[model samples]
Target chain A: MTTSREIRLRSRPQGLPAAANFELATVELAAPGPGEVQVRNTWMTVDPYMRGRMNDVKSYVPPFQLGRPLEGGAIGEVIASNDPSLKPGDLVQSNFGWREAFNAPASSVQKLNTHGLPTEAFLGVAGMPGLTAYAGLLRVAALKPGDVVFVSGAAGAVGSLVCQIAKLKGHKVIASAGGAEKARFLKDEIGVDAVIDYKATGDSAAALTAALAEAAPEGIDVYFDNVGGGHLEAALNAARPYARFAICGMISMYNAEAPVPGPANMALIIGKNLRLEGFIVSNHWDMMGDFLKELGAWHAKGQLKWRQTVREGIASAPDAFIGLFTGANMGKMLVKLA
Target chain B: MTTSREIRLRSRPQGLPAAANFELATVELAAPGPGEVQVRNTWMTVDPYMRGRMNDVKSYVPPFQLGRPLEGGAIGEVIASNDPSLKPGDLVQSNFGWREAFNAPASSVQKLNTHGLPTEAFLGVAGMPGLTAYAGLLRVAALKPGDVVFVSGAAGAVGSLVCQIAKLKGHKVIASAGGAEKARFLKDEIGVDAVIDYKATGDSAAALTAALAEAAPEGIDVYFDNVGGGHLEAALNAARPYARFAICGMISMYNAEAPVPGPANMALIIGKNLRLEGFIVSNHWDMMGDFLKELGAWHAKGQLKWRQTVREGIASAPDAFIGLFTGANMGKMLVKLA
Candidate 1:
């Protein structure tokens, strides 16, 4: 038997989540049963969308139940297997995160062929976040040549990739992030044309609007929104006629106790002839093959770069998840477990 | 020479416009000079979109200059012609509205081919409003089979047509209008599946949302937004996953002194995967052939019904235009200027 430490939901969060909402529990894992495999988790992912699952409301995915180990993307190694399809010492990916290890049916996990990439890369740049940026920018926003893109949360996992993709496609990119450090990373490391340090100037809609106007004098042709609230309003004000907005996520409003008032300039959508579309990456898995092909080429060419803010173990998973709201992570927020 | 009476923009409006914002002027019309034609106006249109031109700011169309005659859709008979393309007593359409008579170059007007339809119908069902309903419902909203549609301002010109087209295409339509009269017209006369009388319910977002929930229990797939504000919020609340919104006009906020707050549930767009798109009919003239073809057949089969609120002569033109805001019209609002 192997002892595994896992985090369970102690209670649902009302607004901003706290570490107290989570409880760490230890579980005993037995040897693999028939057609089963035993795995030891190496890395796990904590995403903004997971916040919605914590609520009891019905949404695209069912809400996470109380007193249960939270589920998410995980990368692990199959240490033992009873099925012929899997062997010892094989890397695998599964949705059994928030735990140190587990035994599950072989069918529940996918064998990973890293193809010279790091094992954790499957949990970040080469995984769901990468596919999200690709699908949102190219398909949802219907990006065209010469289209200028404005991205909010530009230092985060999905948004950082969005900025790079727009630049790679030969479009001007204007990025917005919370602080001076993230702003510098966006401008210097990501090579974005313009960076708005929303933390420095203040996160008010007026501040963002002024910064956007100075950055893109003509106007933005596309807006990829990861942070809502003032960022959405700023994008509306800066949108040119016939602009397209891809609503990927709204991390800013996720913790609100009540519904927040939307952009005051919503009427501009009509006068400016804009199209605002929202999408989830799960519904767009059909594009994964194309995304992997393109992203693989870019990755091999050293054209794609990413950062990770990692917590040490499964015990710190809740802290890593809560840090996302406070801008504690510059790129993908992850938990490192062995 | 003939003396013609016209309405001019005396000043810009601050909020809801008053009669004092307009000025009545008399201009002398001369005989046709070279390629110019003399036309005696018969019917003129007073549309909600005209309110945008009354402001000082630049828009899709130039602002109506103070001390200048207001321009809109007008039908007239050419009394004399200097060009071979037109002749005496030829029916024509031009943008020289708000005037009883005008002398303009023949190239400035489109010669009318009424095809057994009333000449004034050229200004309503056969003109921009009809095409707006077609393009907005079919193309902008991308209505699909089995999609439940929700239309706001269902008693107005463009919205009434949208409700009818959705029904004709074998979709369930839930309509919202003002008062018992318009509600009756929508349900009994227009044959809609459900009706919500916004005026009777006090025009609150909560009222509309409750009514929409009761009407479309399965949730709406498409939202045709003619009235913004509370109606927009209601649509967002009642939208299903991947719902589409065709924003044609926002007559409710056209005369506001400041920008109105948008839908409070704006974040729902991300969770529901909704799409909100704004459009102008003028940019979609390429679809005119398809619209006229479809609308012509519906009109001929008596499948479409409409009502007009008419104010006699050029002197009452301002009254007709202002009446639109007060829910004084059921369908097309017109001025008989002959």
Candidate 2:
């Protein structure tokens, strides 16, 4: 029997999750079944949307059950396989994460083709996050030629990609993030036209509104929303007539124990003629091929860049997941396991 | 010279408007100029949207200037004309309301066609409000064949037409209004599938959510938002995946002294994949021809029905406007000034 350590949900979170809400457990793996493949995980991702799955509620995806190993995206190498498709030592990707190793049907996992980039890029830049940014900015918001793009959480994985894509399309981009480091990274590395450090002012509401106005004097045509609360309000305040907003995620209110208030100026939506739409990346897999091709070209031209903040070992998985809420990672936050 | 009595905005209201904010003035009208026509007003409209014009803030339409006659849709008779396009006694419509008589360039007003409907119908059922409902339901909301529609302010001008049009297209409709009389009108006259009296229960938020759930057990595919706040919150709670909301107006928040809190569960927009869009009718005039054509067919076939709450003379215009907030009238509210 092979031994594997996996993290299980100890309890459902009340508000902000703590490490105690998780428990590390060991499982014994038998030989692979008929269509199953034995795999050892290398890297896994922890994202903000995972918080919603931790609760006992009906959503697009099923909630994570208590005392069960958590599931997420992971990159692994096949150890042994009974299936003809995947061979031993072949790298693959699957939704069997939070564990050192797992046994899943070969059909459930996809063979990894790195496309000349690192394997972890499949978990982030060139993977889900990349597709999310591309679909949201291009299709969901219907980005046009002269659309002034405004993105919240600008230094994060998906947001940075949105800014870069808008810039690539020759549109003026305005970005907002929390810390000084992120602001600098957005300005110097990503080369965004303007940056709003959301944490710099006493009255965050006024500051964000004024900062966005200064960034785009006329108004934003498209808003790629990641951080909702104040950012959504500010976007509404700064939107010109017929602005379109792609609502991707709201990391700011993910941990709320109760319902939080929405933007106060929602009535402005009618007078300003704005459209706000939300979408999940899973519902838009058709765009993956186009995304990968464009991303490969951008990568080859050295115009694409991404950063990783990784925590080592299976035991540190909970910390990596918790770090997302505290803005501990500048880009993609991942856990390395072997 | 002809004498005419008119109402002007004396000052902007702080919260809900009162009669003291208006002044009745006497104007001495000169003879028709080279291209001007002298019109004696017959009927004018008092809509909920006029409340937005009472504020000094900029919006889709310019704010009503203090010490000037408030401008709105009015049907009148040209008593004298200097332009060849119009003749004496020609029925016409112009944005020259809150007054008994006026002289304007003949080209500025359209001679009423009436389409075999009453002259006042041009200001209510067959006019701007009718077009608003048609364009908002068909184009903005993109109402599909199987869409279950929910309408707030279902007894009012725009919303009642939305309910009727959806019903005419053979879709199930759920409606909400304030009082028992409006509820009866919605159920008996409009033939909606369900009605929710928003004032029926003690906890309005819970009541609206439950009512909508019971009304649409499978969940609503489209929401026509005429009243915002609690209604919007209820719609979000009960929205199915890929639901579309065409935000026509928000009567609930128009007279606010300060910005009111928006829906507390706005994050649902992402998980539920909801689309909320706002629009102004003036921006959608291109849809007028299509709307009037459809409306004429429906009326000729005896499938379309409308009601009017008439307030007599120019002096009652302010009360007619104020009564909209207090739920004094159902269906199309108009001021008759012969």
Candidate 3:
């Protein structure tokens, strides 16, 4: 028997989850059965969507059950395998996270080709968040060449990729980040046309409107929304005629105790003929091949870049997740377990 | 020369428009010049969208110019013609309303066939409103056969037609109306599968949610939003996965003195994978030919029916328009001038 440390949901959260809501316990793992493999996790992701799963609500994804190990995107190395497809020492990706080691059916995990790239890229740029930015812009928003695009949460995992991709696609890109450091990173590293430090302004809507007018005088054709509430309202105010908004995530309202108000100017949608569509990347798995090919090419050409705020060891997983609500991370927030 | 009584917009309204905002004056009209025709107005349409044009803000249609005759859909007969394209007694439709008689270029008007149907049908069923219902449902919403559809303001011009068209296409439709009379019209005349009397319920969202659950327990596939605010919130809550919303108009908040709140549950758009698109019928003029052909067939087969609230004379046009905000009209509201 092998001992593995795992984080389990002790109870459903009321508002923002506390450290007590998660219980870290050591579990004895059984040997791999037929068609199964034992994986020692290397890295695990903590995303905003995971917050919604902590509550007992019917949503796109099932709620994380009580007293069970939390599930998310993770990259691990196969330790023991009874399946023909995967062997010991092979690297793989699976939806088995918040645990140091796990035994899952081999069919449930995807074998990874590192291709000399960091294995952790599968959790950030080449993984779920990256694919989200790709499918949302290309398919949902129907972004065109020369289109002016605005992205909120511009320094986060998904928004960072979206800004880079929009720039590479021959479109003018405007981004909004929280702090000075994030704004500087977006401007200096990603090379966005404009970066609005949303934290500096007292009135978010007015600030965004002024920033957008200066960056895109003709108004934005596409708005990729990662943070909803004020960001959504600001985007609506700055949208051009027939603008498209791809609603990826709304990180701002994830910890709200009560129902928050929506944009006051939603009626502008009728006058401007705007289209707002919400999507999940998992639903568009068919686009994975194209996304990987293009992303790989961009990375090789030195046009793509990424960052991470990683916490070491399985014990730090809860703190990492709680930090996402406070905008503590510059890029993807992950926990490394070796 | 002849005298024509015209109603002009004297000034923009602060909130809801009043009769003082318009000026009715008699103007001397000149004889038909080269390529022009003198038309005596017969029927003029007063629609909900006209309210938006009363504000000095930029919108889908340009704001009605101050100190000028307000323009809208009108049907008139040519009393005299100078162009070869039109002659005396020819019935034509033009965007020259709020006037008893006017002289316009013959090229500016569309000669109507009528085809044993009333000439006023060109202003309601065969005109912009009908085409709006067709393109919004078939094209914008991408309506599929056997899909369940929910229509707000179901007894009005566009919503009533949408119900019949959805029914004709083998889809189940649930309708919402403001009163018992309008509900009866929707059920008895339009033959909608279910009807919700929105006014009778104290809480709009709860009432709509309960009504929708009872009517379409599987959840609505398409939502045609004529009334925004709470209705939109209820629709968002009752929508199934991958649902579509064709936002044609939002009559509820048109006369608000202050900025009204939007749907609080818009985040459900993400979990449900919903697509909310706003459209202007003018942008879809390309679908006119197909719209007329299909609508004409339905009317001839007795599969279509319509109602109108007619107020006599151009002087009653202001009252007719104001009545729309109070839900005073059952279907198309019009002013008969001849």
Candidate 4:
């Protein structure tokens, strides 16, 4: 018998999630059934979109069930294998529940070899969020050379890659972060052309205008929308003709008890011929291999950099997860089990 | 010299345009300057988009310069021609301004020879607004067989054709109009599967839900947005996964001083994988001939239906234009200059 800890939703969180929303409990795991592999979870990824899953509303992804281990993208080592695809001690990634150990079928997990890359990167750089940023920027936004990319929520796991990928593709990358320090990391570390501390600006229109004029003197070609509302509106205004905006997340408008105000300048879209698309990462998994290969080379060359505000224990996962809206993390927010 | 009566924008209106903003100017025109043709304007289009032109703001097209003749799409008979491509008494379409007689270059006007089609059809179903609906529906929304389309301001110019075109493409069309008369026209003449009267319902969300249930029992595949606001929100709610929306116009928010309250449920976009696009007709002129051919065939076969609120005299152009937002037109609104 193996002892494993699991975090379950105590109650649905209203607005911003709190410590009261999550509760951890110990579980005893039984031996793996036929075609099942037991995973010893090592790393768990926290993302802004996961907050939406806490609500029991119909969305693209199903909502987290009450009293169930909160499920998300996780990385672990297969300690026991009943499936031939995996052997004991092989690392894997899956949409596994928030458990220290769990027996899942081979169908759920993707085996990870690392191939001289960081082990934790399977949940960050080459993970779902990473591929999301990659496919969205390349496929959805169709980022071209010399195109200007304005990424909202720039410090987060997805937006961070969006900015970096745009930069690597020869685009002038401009990003918005909630704090000055995070904005600094975006400009200094990631080589984003411009970073606006939206918190300091207090006005998205002004921030986007000033930042866009500096970053994209020619015009904005691609707007990778991670945060919606005012940022989306400002982008709409600054967008050149035939611009593409990939609506990845609306974290800005999420958790609002009332209707969020629409960006007043939406009328600009028709005249400007804007393409605004809203999509889910799960829909674009076919592009994953290409993304991993290219991103790995970039990582090995030090052309790509990743940041993590790691919560030391699974116990602190709730705070790190909730801190997303307030901009507590620099890059990807993750939890390490001790 | 041809004596021309013209409707000129004397001043920019503040909110709802009044008759006072326009002045009837009579200008004596000199003969065509070598390559020019003197056009006697017959039918002038009164469209909601003209409202945006009334404001001296940066729009898709330049604003109507104050004290200058307001220019728009019109089909006219060439009273006199000096160009090789055209002859006297030929029917042509051009942006010849809102004037009874104007001297325009031969390059500006395209001769429309009844070609077994009604001459007025050039100003309505086969012209800018009509081609706009076609391009936007097919090119942007990508409406396919069995797609469910919802058009707001459905009895109006662009929205009416959008509903018909979507239906012609084997789609279920749901329309929302301002009054009972417009609603009846949408169902009876427009052949939309369902109709919602905005005036009677008084609530966008409820009316849309009811109309959506009736017309799009399957789900909303495309949103033809002519009326923006809660209607956009309503369409967003009724959208299926990978649904497309063409933001052609936003009559609901045009006069709004502030941002319209949004669907607050926009986070649903991430879950649904929706595509909301904004387009212009000028960018899609290459498909004009094909559209005109198909629409003419549909008309000849009696499969296509149309109606127009012909406001007699050039002086009524401003009033007729403003009546668009008020749902004063049954189908296309054309200002007749006699």
Model 4 per-residue lDDT at B219: 80
Candidate 1 residue pairs in backbone clash: none
Using TM-score as the yardstick, the better of models 2 and 4 is 2
Could you tell me how far off, in angstroms, the CA of residue B203 lies in candidate 4 after the best superposition? 4.6
lDDT of 4 by residue, A1-338 (tens): 88998889999988878899999998898988899999998888888888888989877678998899998888888999988989998888888847788988888898878888777777777787799899899998888776888899888888999988888878788898888888889989998988878888775665767766666677788988888887887788789998999889888877787767667677778888898888888889999889988997897788988888888667877887888878888888888863
TM-score comparison, 2 vs 3, better candidate: 2
C-alpha TM-score for every candidate: 0.98, 0.99, 0.98, 0.96
Clashes of 4: 1
For each candidate, what is chain B's TM-score? 0.98, 0.98, 0.97, 0.94
> Backbone clashes in each candidate structure, one number apiece?
0, 0, 0, 1
The candidate that wins on DockQ is 2
Model 2: lDDT equals 0.91
Prediction 1 global C-alpha lDDT:
0.93
Model 1 stretches astray by more than 4 angstroms: none
* Candidate 2 CAPRI classification by DockQ: high
Return the lDDT, model 4, position B266: 65
Candidate 3 lDDT by residue in tens digits, B116-220:
889888888888889999999999999987679999988888998999899899889999989999999989888999998888874367678888888889999
Each prediction's RMSD over C-alphas, in Å, is 1.1, 1.0, 1.3, 1.9
Q: Order the numbered candidates by lDDT, best leading.
A: 1, 2, 3, 4
For model 2, the stretches where C-alpha displacement exceeds 4 angstroms are: none
* lDDT of model 1 at position A100: 92
* Between candidates 3 and 4, the lDDT winner: 3
True contacts kept of 1: 0.89
What is the TM-score (0 to 1) of candidate 1? 0.98
Model 4 Cα lDDT, one tens digit per residue, B211-256: 6666677788889898777788788878899999898888876766
